[model samples]
Target chain A: DAGITQSPRHKVTETGTPVTLRCHQTENHRYMYWYRQDPGHGLRLIHYSYGVKDTDKGEVSDGYSVSRSKTEDFLLTLESATSSQTSVYFCAIREAGAYEQYFGPGTRLTVT
Target chain B: AQTVTQSQPEMSVQEAETVTLSCTYDTSESDYYLFWYKQPPSRQMILVIRQEAYKQQNATENRFSVNFQKAAKSFSLKISDSQLGDAAMYFCAYRSYTNAGKSTFGDGTTLTVKP
Candidate 1:
């Protein structure tokens, strides 16, 4: 198991509310990624951070934002939650020059 | 752009039998990586095996092995002596060597191992 952890393992929020999920890692890996898993779509990348204050959009970046101020913490925020955003979010970290990514326990979010 | 496809939505195998999961990908990049990840009922993602495009030989981890045909754009996972613990959703993913380690994943195949 990797030293990765996702906070708020399960959450439910009403539409149009603000919600943020946190991913913390102890490995100090340079790359951190956020993905959302949905039926028939598998896991889609939401966003990724290569280093502190450096981030990039993924295939499904809409309706989500991410920030990394430190090496160990990466945060994903849904500015205004929507029903479409209801899914399982996962956080993964990859060390530099590593081919495999270590995943954290997923966070399940529900938007009513 | 890259896309991963897992044609089988579900499969079942008797315990101690061997089963293979199919995966095909489309990529223009010559050098990349392919991976198989297993997500049990607990929903924790575990890396089953990985194959580097540059490597001609397939990669194996214990009972899990991959058949990598780079020219065919095919990567399949073979589980030998399957156990009930192998029952889970298996995902095939593709990552380019140039990208920042971002991956494109297939819809996934659910494996059912009957004891």
Candidate 2:
């Protein structure tokens, strides 16, 4: 509903293989974030971007990396996928001076 | 880092009735934001309501309202006229205005609406 789109809605990859999930926003929001949702743990931040070429690590950024080369695109990559990395990844965006964030449909990733 | 807590792991409510979900947070900062996100079977994280720390008045969105006790660091969500579709996992989240946009979320409370 926030003009946010996440690519590869579902993904399956082998362990040790690299996987990348893409989050694109059409609204050109100033901030974008990636989060992973698990069973007991609600949602943990992975990485975020405040602007083009500006990125920062989140709480659960150990196994993930993010890039924001453009204003409308943010990419999250896992260099070596693992079973523990399987999760439902979400992309969220917040407008300037806004206190709330809008989330996109999530992507379910499985690492076998 | 700010932390959000939802002690109720699960709760049940009758259809057309009302239910309240409790959420507490810890933060040293004076200004921040609290949010309630609903995740249904579709797995989409929907923003149900939010409250600004600086504002004394609570925030409401249609049937969803928040009882924000700034002094107690408590933010509870009240759902009126609960429908079957309201059965979902409700998460409490906190974000610091001075920090990065990263939000800390509670484990979540699974709400079940009984007909």
RMSD of each: 0.7, 1.0
| Candidate 1 residue runs with Cα over 4 Å from true position | none
Question: Which DockQ-derived CAPRI band holds candidate 1?
Answer: high
Worst 10 residues of 2 chain B by lDDT: B94-103
Clashing pairs in 1: none
Interface RMSD of the candidates, in order: 0.8, 0.9
Per residue, candidate 1 scores C-alpha lDDT tens digits across A1-112 of: 7899999999999999999999999998999999999976679999999999999999999999999999999999999999999999999999989998999999999999
Model 2: per-residue lDDT, tens digit, B13-115? 9999999999999998998889999999998888898888899999999999999999899999999999999999999999888666578999999999999
What is the C-alpha lDDT profile of model 1 across B15-52, one tens digit per residue? Answer: 99999999999999999999999999898999999999
Q: In CAPRI terms, where does candidate 2 land? A: high
Per-candidate local distance difference test: 0.96, 0.92
lDDT of 2 by residue, A5-105 (tens): 99999999999999999999999899999999998888999898999999988888998988999999999999999999999999999987888788989
Best by the lDDT measure: 1
